[model samples]
Target: MEIDYSTIKVIGFDADDTLWVNETYFREAELEFAKLLSGFETPNKIDQELFKKEIGNLPLYGYGIKAFTLSMVECALELSNYTLPNATIEKILNIGKNMLNKPVELLDGVEEVLEQLSKKYRLILATKGDLLDQERKLEKSGLTTYFHHIEVLSDKQNANYSKLLNHLDINPSEFLMVGNSLKSDVLPLVNIKAKAIHVPFHNTWAHEMVTQKETSGKKYETINTLRDLLKMV
Candidate 1:
């Protein structure tokens, strides 16, 4: 089935892996964290346990480096049966701090795409993460000026998107979301009657992965890179 972008009045971009490097940092941090706990478990087992802790803690802390850091601490304590050394814990803390302080690296053509699209459509930053961290990255990204509205969501479900579009007075048909996660960015919008374009990141958190059955019949476009938007919209 053919879809139309002519009616799209607003284009939403996912922040983390969409406009800049984010998940990659988390992956690197996880590796460092696993190594830190190697005394208690092998790197592979440590990684598995940390992921379980993260998933278990998602409801309590939501998503972001802070939550992830906390999960790491918890996982370390649990894996070591609470005998983990103070130095190891400190290293974990430093790992999270380093991730937070790392410089923002924008993906190729992110600026050009935003610059071009902002001229014709209202662009919004519709991403879910720690509010302070997201704001910090936005400031560092130097792309904040392109967004007409910025939203830091707790989660990117259908209701969340619906509320954002409703507040902006944009009908679902007139909103298009571009992002890296099919679960968070594509499926939710498509379910809400909005158009979506998937620009996949090289790495994604396992929690965000959806089965083929979930996306098999979805109507949306998938582009290889952000620059590809120039040709589409």
Candidate 2:
């Protein structure tokens, strides 16, 4: 079956790994966190527990470096049997600070793709994370002017996308989303009768990953690079 873009009036782009480096920093921070707690638990165990902690805290903390930092602190305390040193705690805080302060590195062809697409379609940014952090990265990326609207979503699900489309006064068939996360960016839009293009990043956070069974019969196109979007739409 052929997916049509003829009715697409708005093109939504995901930030973080879609437009810039994100998961890599988290991966790096996890490694550092594991090293900090190596005395109490092995690196592998620390990694597993931290992932669980992050997921468990999602409802309360939402998402971002600040939330991740808190999870690290809690995990450390538990892993250390509440005997974690102040110095180790401080190091954990620094991990989050460093991640927050890290530079935004845009993927190749991002600007080129946005510039071309914006001319023919209404471009909007739809990303999920801490509002301030996403705003800061957008400012740093220097791609803000291309977006007609910027949405920092609490989460990306079918309902969320449906609400967004409703707010825009557009039909579901008229919106198309492009992102690296199939779970957040692709499936929701697809499920809502909207179109989506998957532009995979090199690394995906564990939570963002979907199993083959989840994508078995999903109708979407996966491109190797953002540059490929130029030819498709």
User: What lDDT does the true structure give each of the candidates?
Assistant: 0.94, 0.94
Which residue pairs clash in candidate 1?
none
Global CA lDDT computed for model 1: 0.94
Per-candidate TM vs. native? 0.99, 0.99
User: In candidate 1, what are the lDDT values of residues 13-79, reduced to their tens digit?
Assistant: 9999999999999999998988788778999899899999999998999999999999999999999
Off by over 4 Å in 1: none
| Quality of model 2 by C-alpha lDDT | 0.94
How much is 4 displaced in model 1, in angstroms? 1.3
lDDT of 2 at 111: 98
lDDT: worst 10-residue window of model 1: 31-40
Error of 1 at 186 (Å): 0.3
* Segments of candidate 2 deviating more than 4 angstroms: none
